[model samples]
Target: MNAYGINPDPSEITEITPAVDGVESIPLPLYGYNVSAGFPSPADDFIEEYLDLNQLLVKHREATFFVRVSGCSMTGAGIYSGDILIVDRSLDPAHGKIVIAVVSGELTVKRLVMRNGRAILRSENPNYPDIPAGDELRVWGVVTSVIHKV
Candidate 1:
């Protein structure tokens, strides 16, 4: 969880797909004050905490895997191609949550929605059609965080 609840522009996340990897414990000095985008303010010398990005981003280390987005289907939600997604297999996939599911022998990231006892993989982009996830639906994990680079 974010220590100060200060949400970034996109989000904080990581993991390399294909080969399962582990995040190193790299604690960086975290200043308490929020960096202003406009006028500059007096800097605070005190370091509030040492933030370990890996710990803050990954909840379940063993169950989490990073998958890089391959398309623009979820661009409306701030997810874009080449962005790494932190997925937790331990988390239960619920409605209105982004998830990675195998649809027709292919992996696609979409929002999960339940409609009248049926599951639907809703794409964030209007160009993509909503996929009905039925027998072939095998959810790999739920997206916990998104790592988009500037």
Candidate 2:
């Protein structure tokens, strides 16, 4: 089972193409003070400087790609539908790391695991079942971070 607790149909997968227009980058202002969720503080007025998210998020620009999540299978791992996943193809697909893969020509995102010397794709949600990584399974990349808007 994938992270959403079920096998994703091939039709459900969508490949996001990188923007090729003149749009180069977006730099947002970073705050010097750390915002607290509990109580209000006076330090919230400080501005650090302009921060480029690409520098902070993309370690390897050539191998990094962004993909939009479409299902709830990964919600247990804090990856919900509509979230953007930063995938790094150059990173090692180590055990316990979340990864994107193609199984039988269908793309999927799941947590990689090893059981009895065999690779298994585990879903973060309990409702989904574990899927065995068969001969047709190919690891595409490791998920580095997930971006979700409030």
| Best candidate according to lDDT | 2
lDDT of each: 0.74, 0.77
Clashes of each: 0, 8
TM-score, structure 1 vs. true = 0.81
What TM-score, over all chains together, does every model reach? 0.81, 0.81
For model 2, how does the per-residue alpha-carbon lDDT over 53-90 read when each residue is reduced to its tens digit?
A: 77788888778888887777778899887788888889
Per-residue lDDT value at 81 in model 1: 82
Q: Tens digits of per-residue lDDT for model 1 on 37-57?
A: 753343556567889888888
lDDT of 2 at 23: 43
